[model samples]
Target chain A: MDSPNNDYLIKKINYEIKKRNIKKVPFLEIRNNRLQGVVSSGSDIRRVYVCVIDNNNNTFSCHTNNNRKCGGLDTQYVCSHLSALISQANLRSEEDEKFDTLASTTNKQGDTKARYPEVFARFQHYLKYLQMEATIESIPEMEWFISN
Target chain B: MTAKITLKENDHINNPMIFSNDVKLDQVFEIQHQLIQVFSNGFSKLNSKGIETLKEINIAFSTSPLNTLISEAITGLNNNQLTSSNFDLLAIVMASIDGSAYDSLFDELNKLMENQVSLIDNAKEINYTSNTEDHENFLESIKSWLIDLAIMGFTEINMDVLESFEQVMDTLENIPELMRLNVILRGFIEEITTEIPITSQDEFPAKRWLGLWLRSYLLTMQLPKENVQSIKDCKLKIIGVQKYSHDYFTLYTFHGILDHEGNNRLIQIEAKKFTINEVSNNELLDLLNSTHPELFKGLEENLVIQVKQGMISGNYLILEKFKTTTTSFDIYETLAVLFESKTISYNKQNPYNRHPLLLKYPVLCKIENITKDGTSKFDWGDIPIRFDKVGTLNEKWKLANSKGIFGFIQFDNGWWISPVTILGDKNQYIGYTYSQDRSGKNVYEVLKERSNAILRSKS
Candidate 1:
């Protein structure tokens, strides 16, 4: 896909997500070569199994027994649930970069731990993953994706 | 110590008519003329014995007219038309009337004058002038008039009337003639007090007002030795002292023994022009120990001197000593105070199940479960976040949740809620459903398609 087409697809996904008011990011994880997650069609808590081709492209597919289909799952069309997931992925990458910067700057002084204990606790969790010598390839593309 | 009585504004009077600016001086003079005419009619019927004596004259025919005249005079006096002549005429007429009528009329006039002084003091624009000569002349006239009334057996009237006369004497100190008249007035009071027997129980009609008046009269005469002895003889207990101003202090006392009327009324002695020496608490204690040690015996151990400062424009202090008792409270009592003072409301139907205090101190909660129908359950970990201090928790939660695929719920108790599905749009009020059914279909996507279809159909 061309760069313009990818941008258009991302925009379409975002518009759909906003239109549907899809607030919750569905459970997503990287398994084998596929990016898999559950995404809500709208406000209904019912879930749709979405599988995306992990080629850094906008190719994805969704399946649900309830006859509800996300048109945006196709490369030609985009849905809000797909847009919300994409947006969630982008946000996770930016947050990871910020955490890396904060960690590097606050390496000497652990004073930030006292001021923001919650953030420091999560940072410590990230540090544990780093300590295990886990490379970026070992983790899911979305840094916030927690396996159920 | 020399007693210095600086008169402060009396606050007891609240009369709009007295404070009205439209009152004319001629109107006041007219009322005065009418009062004098009534008094002259009463005086004409008196023969030498009747005029010279305080005996009941057939002035019964003139009582109703005299009362009407006095009422009109009072209205004028209260409206600030009280001239020196009017005061003199009222004093003489009050002395000559029968004791019962005199007592009632004198009381009314006394109240009117008090209200007039109060109104003048309170008015922002003072139009009336203080006539020093007129006031002095009125004092002189009252002294001579009292002497004549005393010789005519009018001294035996109710003590309430004497009390009213004492109040009139209070305003006379500013007059220059008061120096000589004070001596004469002291003699009269001394003679009267001697004749009027002081008793805790008596059949006298004026016993209560007279007993109170005698104590005040002795104090005014600067006879502290006699004053103390008189208080002890009459069995009076000094309760408290209220300092209204630098020069005026009202000493409140109750009778140690009930009067003949079985009334133990609180007697207020208005001591004016009293000078207070510069003394700390210790110095005052030492002085009290030396001069009046018996005064301290009545006080409780835990006496709290509550000095209410800044009551007036200047640096004024009103010190009141009150006995205090220490009471200890347990946990239950502390809870009672909390329940009584702090308003806490609870709603059983609210999703957060929050008390008002909890909403005040909002905490971030992890979304534990989200039903397919959009309702979510949250688990707030150990950390406490004050919702009031954190501006817009919905926005902050949205920003924080952007970094994670896991959903979170942020709400201000019952005020509003940010459901997990529409995390970014915190202001959206999408209905929540807590059903556990997972339809294997994205409800958000389904709703979005339906909304788009509706929009497409409408367009």
Candidate 2:
């Protein structure tokens, strides 16, 4: 489930990305229930990882390889690369919701999942090769990531 | 019992003028008899009334007749006619009189007496080359006389007596032959007796006398020039710099070692204190270096830093200065490098939670969107915050929470760090304020402790 302040987060991410002039956008894909990608600038590429936990009202835990330039994982605000990825994730989620509603209304057979062929193809690849796991539940969920 | 006075047939008395061809020798003898009788009677009265008689004599000496008589008596001593006994009587009479009245004559009599004593003691060596020795003996005699007068004056001092002694010393200082001797005596006495105890009542007069004496001595003597020359010739080395503060002055006392004429002595060579506005920074530094070379050397070796360039690359902060560059991944890395080869353990458990590096190098960080007036609009950045402006750590935490930024800021001209609330309405960014402890332990306190530890170890 998306956080209630998820809109605010999306807006903040967009603002930060625009302000920082983040040119190279990352291709975010969910793997093992974690959203991860490689953020690149020219020849330099930094790996970014984000995990959404159900506890703490659906908070996002983020980390970047370039901790110094991107700030530590424990930073209050995410780095520009992470913010860009988050904005993309929110847009993708909204598109998926719209597609789901359109398919339910238009077809009784429920075979309208392939409405956007490109998105369908990407989602299929994420499911098959990435081994994307369903969001699981633990008794006491991890509070925060300890980034080295 | 005719009260007849015996006349000595000395060449000075035989001069053909006063008792010459027209006047009888009996008239001359009668005149001498009357003068002797008057002196004898005066002495008897002086014995009966000491200070009163002296006062009366001072009055008489001021009058024309007695003044003339005193002048003539001084001249008689200079001539071959006056015997030592007669000179002694004349000196006694002159001692009772005011010296200022018969200044030149009295001075002449003093010189004649000095010369007579030298002649009697060292007559065999009486020549032009012995003039220096004679002058030295004369100086000794005058010094003793002055000292005796000073003692007497101090014993029964009144304003009048103090003034009289001052006048006598003043007159003596004016005399070219006695001037140097007077200076030496005054300086010697003052240098030795500076620590002497005195009653509150005596302190003022004593100090006045000393001040006047020293002023006259300095005015008349050329010793200071010689002393300065000697000092210039000596080798001076700075030992230390001591700082003292009072309401009016902040004094930097420079202690030094003086190697003068093969003698080594430690002394407080100079003290320089001026208001901040009164002195330039370069001048103050120069004075510090000159006066306290050793201290300056130590500071230059360790603490004195000239920042050429500071740049942040990734997590590494690079500082370039003194023809050398140093790079550290973070403040911790920098401090580790600084405290390198030392067995100091840093708090490495939660690295991102605290920034100890900001305390040491506040200039290394840059604040985004700083206004033209040099104030930051952001809640948190590397803004220069005054130490006094910083509230308590708990207070800072509240402000930081309100502003949505960490309480970290540079304080006290970047020497220390403190939790600060930026005084701007715009909350531009959500600054990192979270610490694992949840206690009031801010980054500043952690950095301060670590820096102090490093400093202590190095020191």
Candidate 3:
């Protein structure tokens, strides 16, 4: 199969942002399999790029210029991007399951194998949230100092 | 770059009811609330005195781990070198007096020393006869352990978990040693007590607590009891344990309830935990002799009796030489009868069978009948696996693995066979018929199919 289309992915991301009802929708772009985006938190429009997959084999990163602080959009952008990809993959798997051969041979004991990847993604997200809770619990007056 | 801490958006972001950690005290307070809720619900109803005892549990978040607290207390005690043996104990007591009205815990120690003066005096080995002193020492030892556990930074100041380490320790300590043993021996005895699931009975309130306690207790003292409820209700469960452990002596009455009231029934007497240690074997034998001196009067009764009496003197050797006889059937049928009866004792007194000393106690059954199933009787050739289905085993292998069979196997041809089928020379699948074909595939094809299909179906 051909690689997923860049323009199509950007449009898909835009549609997801609207669907999720997230205000200040960011513009997403892709070039040669690399995902790029511009997201602003009302005060600042930061340029971000998901350039490298981390140790868990997930691509999540943000870049900054000389004068400013760390990227605001990095964490959420990564989470949202991964969530959207999962949604798309699930949709495609559902369509693929319509074929009898795909349903029988690949599907073990009448159950589809499509849910595992989504489950893994959900587990990773849960761990991330736990880490966030731990960070919040640690230190005195922990009032979003990084975002601050 | 510089490291910075931030509140995770997920915390209280989705859930409106949950408060955010923006205010530090709120987070700590919330954690404390959660811990209290968990502690109250999880542990309060265990015992009548539980609620009051739980109130005294000290919970506070500390940066140090429990082991670190213990080591630190040990070090502090060493610095003074006041008392070498129980220094660790003194340190724990001193450290845990945070909320008490004491400046220096040395005063409290002084008070304890004065109060337990008799115990301190009787600590010498010569004073071992004093039961009260021994009990005091036991309590003191337990308290020392509890205090050490408490000092181990068991909880965060915010009460991170439902129960503190000290609470867990105290709870385990509170369980009597006997109850603990019952719990530990539960799983092992569960297989033996097939009458009714013991936990299902309303009378067995201490089921969970028993299981937990016995696991800890059995590590210390390996007494034999199968399951906790058997120990609690005093059922066949204890019989199984006694059967497993040979050295320990177990004496129990069989009739459950009405036996307590005025009722005339024969009591089944058996040993549970019978262990004659190397030091006490001679002492035990002497005790048995002295206790049952009447046994000497009945020595003739203990003698083995021949059912078909025969008298042979000079003809014994000549008759043996002349009688060259061979039996058509296996001697196993007769031996199996003796085996089930347990009349075939395999101990120092008997030498024929050298069965391993796996169990210390013999499970004595009241021989009700000689032909019944799974009862206290010998059913001679009802061998778990049938020899009649020996030849077509490979074909009707399905019948071999019936639930009641002793050994079972499923073959590639939808046939399940028993280990006995290996009797057939290279063709091990000698006996068995197929189970009715499901999915239109013959039994053998399904058996040879990827192991998953067979296993999933079995499940």
Candidate 4:
């Protein structure tokens, strides 16, 4: 009951990786009883991409880049983005501490995507990964960017 | 400070092969090669050339005994979606495909086949008079076959398992053992042979696999088939309807129960999928009056009618007379019939009769969850479980579902219900084909909305 463990994560999200075709995680943030992260898009790279989970209530949500309310809430039970976020989250408690029980998945309904800009700011790494931070550093590779 | 984080290794979570992505394309070819070698010379000789062809080609994996793997090889070979398996199975799959394409490989399988005559004789030995232990052993073997199909996935099961399954199914179909799970076996075969697709590397759904049928068969196998075969006339009230399609034709089988002359039976009748050009109830009634005045009362849900000179073929029924009883049945009654009769005794905890079908036939349902844009959702009893909305439920369904639906409902990749005409139901009965919607607006209105949107955008 301490926190989500490898066994629980695998049990909950194995299908997301195999069946839903989730590739890998792009970015994730794990805090007290919550996980927020950006998952690599399984189908489209430009898809709305953010995931949130509150272990306290086992409620979750997802959002587009603009933080518009999206399918992030819809896939709380079995979403690939949530799967990626949970798998990549730092759920392990004090290293040697063994724990049992998982965030019981009751599929509670609610969305907080209205605060997209505010909550979105919490994922500073996500903004960094999105290359939103303008760096004046030049790269020869920019000229070699393949359009196709 | 990034605390000393040690990620402990869990073998099941980490084993790549256990959670493998897919059978490596090279492995598929290798498996194909070894099987071809196995089939080259038939049972008599292994010339190393072998059974290199598939007897049938289909888009998905089947659960039917012999032809399933053969079709799987053709299907997966086409899609390159075969899951990982061991080397021996690779040989079997290739051989299965090869045998299907060219020779009847029974020459090889014949060695594994139980002699039908001897098998039947032994089965007879374990009759009602047989020891309890013998019956247990026999039933265990059958359950074992179910367990095998439940566990071994597509492109992974070996020939021996399939042969045993087929042999047991064949025996059960022919002998009195079928009396135990007759209705379930008929329905289950119809189900598996029709839909099931390729599965990935994961545990087979165990609760679903063991199934209500297994429980029912275990409970009811001891009961005797009532001496009601002598009944000259019987009413075939429908239990359920399933649709299957081939290249050209869409086929429908109406499976139902006939409780007549002190005997009860589960029987299925087949019909082709037909569209009614009639635009109203009066038009349909007129057509019935003109074409087949015998059905002047009109066909209702469950098609309640008494048939004379009816012949029962295995689990199927053939009719000579059709005199409409125009009987009225509740939706709950129809569902109860679909569930085995014994469970109607009622469960103490849940007031409703314990339905064996929590997943397949039973829907954890609430009505009016349909939408105008062709997406569908449903509420499960007290729990408002939201289904993942996908493409094309056809907005027209919302019209029917508004009053609540009671017919063949399915939860495949998409959710749909083919509303049936129950005599007593307040829900306005909509025929499977859209005849009532004369405006043509309601007919397939949202069928191609998504596809058209994609095309228009691309254009």
Candidate 5:
């Protein structure tokens, strides 16, 4: 069966994490895979796969293991990630506002840009690191593991 | 000019009525009508002309107040033998010729004028020729006769009786003003019927005690039946008064069930002298249970009394007497119990989904400190203070030990930490926390006994 809708669910999960202020565990390059009609019991079962990237750019994958699939567990996982991201973003936004306000007061445009180079550089580095992380598990194995 | 009164230099006498010949009277009239229309429609629609005209009037007058003008007007009315129509037009002119200049004065004049009843020429012809040496006593007797006639005519109408214009008027001339042609035209309908002959008017006794008792009853019974019948058979007896501050009214009736059956049943109960908000849901529930034991005799465990305050946000009701011996209590089961008791009758459907049982009374219990080591617990006595800034709570807690009760609790880092007691010893502990603060985070340790047991149980 086609994978469960991830794009919409991911945004919602990210939003809740940010809202709840939940601390993030160490992980990277998260992916949510929705597997429908995967069970062999003449009946259908849906599954969601969670994957994240580490500092070494390695992908770590997990799935909801309970017999009764709970939307709350999926929500909890995404919420934790979003919460960490939100806390970091809040701190960064405050610093950015401060920097921009300070920079606007400066007479030279180049000097102002130079003053916030480290912040811009670190943001770029994190973006590249996130993009470089790879998903190692195959679709067949993911489906097999999700059903089991 | 018919007459010109010369004024001394630096005289600040203000005449509110000053006219200019240069301005067209018709245009001024139109603008004045528009201004009145704007005011009638609401205060929001005041055009530039309206505002300017109002400002001009305010600037011209309001120096030597309108009380003197009113007194002069009263004298003029008596001397000129002016008709009620003329007096009414004059009053309207005084009110509207300027913007709010004579408003307060008019109000005072109206109040003074309402007390006196202006009788018709037929009633005025009854002249007593030196009937008694005491003139005041004679006039009072005449007034009493007039009052009885007025009340007899008024009781015909089924509408709730408020004080009438005649009852308010205190003067002989003012009494006649009530039946003025212009006054009637101004929507002041005759409160009493015209079938009764023009006897003397009667004065209404200011029923302050009755009004207070009714207000107190209404407040105590938050949501009474839709139709609160005029207290026909009701007799209010005062039980006791505490230093003239708290006066209690005890109403006794035969039928005690408070329901929406609309079966005109006589109900009676003893209620304490308290504000409407002070009537706790638990008390109402207890009364209900006691009166109708069949509804909840053996079903007490399943029944819950939910009292919500304000209904929008999360506020909790504490089953006051149900505090546990130890620390834990089943909050979920308590909530379930409360919700189950809310049986919605087909007739009593609430439009706001406000099930009567969902109403929650606020719980304001504090865990008191009894010892220095903070290990002892006791009943809270004083009002607890709330602190917002960091370090304020810690500092205040340290200062206000066993010496005295200081109302203080500090909120910081998504928690309200208060100095509370456990086993008769006082200690600092977390009082409350938001769910948003704990989502995806490890559960923070809280003192089991110190927390709002309901919240802890639910968690």
Candidate 6:
């Protein structure tokens, strides 16, 4: 079940983190063979983009409000949005959520669009942490969802 | 290095860090929960009980920051309803107080928790220190902190711990005995905090690190000599030979062999130190032998050999003597031995045992496009393995038509196999000048950086 094992994607994300000053990730998830998250833009506090990076297939999609595709598809380039999403995916992975990076991910080479709807929804749910989570007991969905 | 130097038994009582009692602790947790319940009900309905509870908790601890922050959080809400960011900050403060919560007090609640140390003492008697046990206690704290990082991952913790820990390490680094231990941990902090891990190569000396698990285990052993036993001679059909490398030097070679049921498993055994000082793989053949030399002729991956004798130390076998027999397996067959086995990691039937990192496996996978820059994933079973450190091409890749290749799959940030040799006309070994930095730093880098020193010197 090998997906993407932290090589190119992480390196690019690290560069983006420094360049964009992305100190607080707030929300991130690695599921269904790619790294995905809804990240709040540093410049625009109200703006958040649902970004995804599948290192195995070498493709990514950032459903930003614009039509621009991240440099992830271009040679030697990675989108800042996608980079922030993947920067901490491994660092944030919990125990039972153990996912093996799939070597057989070539099947997803052109199938990047299929994962967006679900990823976008997860991003919306993940945003709840920044709001008041008034419950006395810890919420299960907010389990790995950490904030400083 | 299980050399016992009995210190004191009541050290925990002598210098306690967690001083909050059960009753006070219960009150803290109770106050936190009620605060959440009140806040969760929303600020518009800020119940009197919740506000009173905040006042009570703030006053109870005599914690000034807590009192000021609590007031600032709710004070102006009625007048000008704070921004979502302010509400976010308040939520974080409330969540940080989640009961069973003393650990977080160090980071987010920095102004609160006490009991800190800044000592220069170099005493073997840790109990004698007033604030902190500058030697053994510091070592213990580091180990536990590392385990927490491993189990919880770096992102889960607040980044401030890194700065605080660096301060502690800086103060403790001057002690000669703690130098090696500090350097490794310091290397890890330097890498993981600043650079993302993408490969397993670093400036860390693997030659000293491979014995980490063995060292930590033996450190606690009371009957070190009694644990050493000998197996006269046995036939071992080698399953695989795992090599952990730093530069050109092979750090450690994990030899995977067949057990009685013919199941392949990776066993970690050092060439030395079983009892008082520990024995080697073949030392069991001698009643009181000092060293057991390893014979490597017949021990290639997927080869059969007759082991003349070996030592069984804990869960690993140290093969002192062995003869090369004839054997060969195709690529798929070899892959089956490496991955298809029921026990890829330590299990009940494994020759393996508990280890902090994953067992390195010998893997053969096709290379699509070798990472030319720092932005490509090296294909493993067609999946991409991120390789940021690309070494200059030293050997010929054109020799094999660049088809299937051989590499060692060990645990780094994730499971990674760094392709070292391509299956060419003959089995040609390839070389690369992998760039040494944070990305090239293996998760094992810090591992090598840490306890192998303390346990080794103490042993």
lDDT of 2 by residue, B113-144 (tens): 23211111111111222112334433334433
Q: Candidate 6 at B451: error in angstroms?
A: 25
Per-residue C-alpha lDDT of model 4 across residues B1-459, encoded as one tens digit per residue:
111111011111111122112334333234433433232212223232322322211211133232343354444433433232212122233222322311122222122222111100011111122222335555556654443442343224333444345446544444443332432443344333322332432322222222332333332223212111234677656544433321112234444556656545554555431121111223323433454443323233435667776655334455556666767555445544434343211101010101111111222122444454433353322221221111112324444434333343322222243333322343333322324445433211121222232223321
Q: Tell me how far the alpha carbon of residue B256 in candidate 5 is from the true structure, in angstroms, after superposition.
A: 19
lDDT of 3 by residue, B236-256 (tens): 100000011111121111110
Candidate ordering by TM-score (highest first): 6, 4, 1, 3, 2, 5
lDDT tens digits by residue: candidate 1, B1-459: 112211112110111122212323333233333332223223323334332232111122133434434444434334434343333334323322212221233234335323211111122222222223345446444644443332223223434445456545545534443332332353344334333432322222222222222222222221101001111112222223221111011111111111112222222222221111111123223333343333333222212222122111001111122222232112123222323443211111111111111111111123333323323333322222222121122333443433211111122212222222222222111111122444334432433443343223321
- A1-148: candidate 6 lDDT, tens digit per residue: 1111233223322232121112334345454345666555556444455566676466666654232333344334445665555545544333213322421123233333635655544433222212211211111111010110
Any runs in candidate 4 off by more than 4 Å, and if so which?
A: A1-148, B1-231, B239-247, B261-266, B273-298, B301-303, B334-431, B437-459
How many angstroms is residue A55 displaced in model 2 relative to the true structure, after the best TM-score fit? 99
lDDT of 1 at B259: 15
Give candidate 1's whole-model lDDT: 0.27
Angstrom error at residue B191, model 1: 35
Interface root-mean-square deviation for each candidate?
A: 43.1, 36.9, 33.4, 26.8, 35.4, 23.2
What is the lDDT, from 0 to 100, of the residue B438 in candidate 2? 42
TM-score of each: 0.18, 0.16, 0.17, 0.28, 0.14, 0.31
Best by TM-score: 6
TM-score of chain A of 1: 0.38
TM-score of chain A of 2: 0.33
lDDT score of residue B342 within candidate 2: 32
For residue A141, model 2's alpha carbon misses the true position, in angstroms, by: 86
Two-chain complex of model 4, DockQ on C-alpha atoms against the true structure: 0.01
lDDT tens readout by residue for model 5, B1-459 = 111111111111122222332333344344444433323322233345544544443333334343333334334333433333223222233222321222222233224323121111111122222212233332333333332322233222221222232233223213222111112211112212111222322221112111121121111111111211222221111111100001011111111111223321112222211111112223323444454342232122222222121110001011112111222223223222322343211111111111111111111122344333332232322223322211112434453433322111221111122322111123222211112322332211111111122122221
Q: Whose lDDT is higher: candidate 1's or candidate 6's?
A: 6
Instruction: Determine the TM-score of chain B of model 1.
Output: 0.21
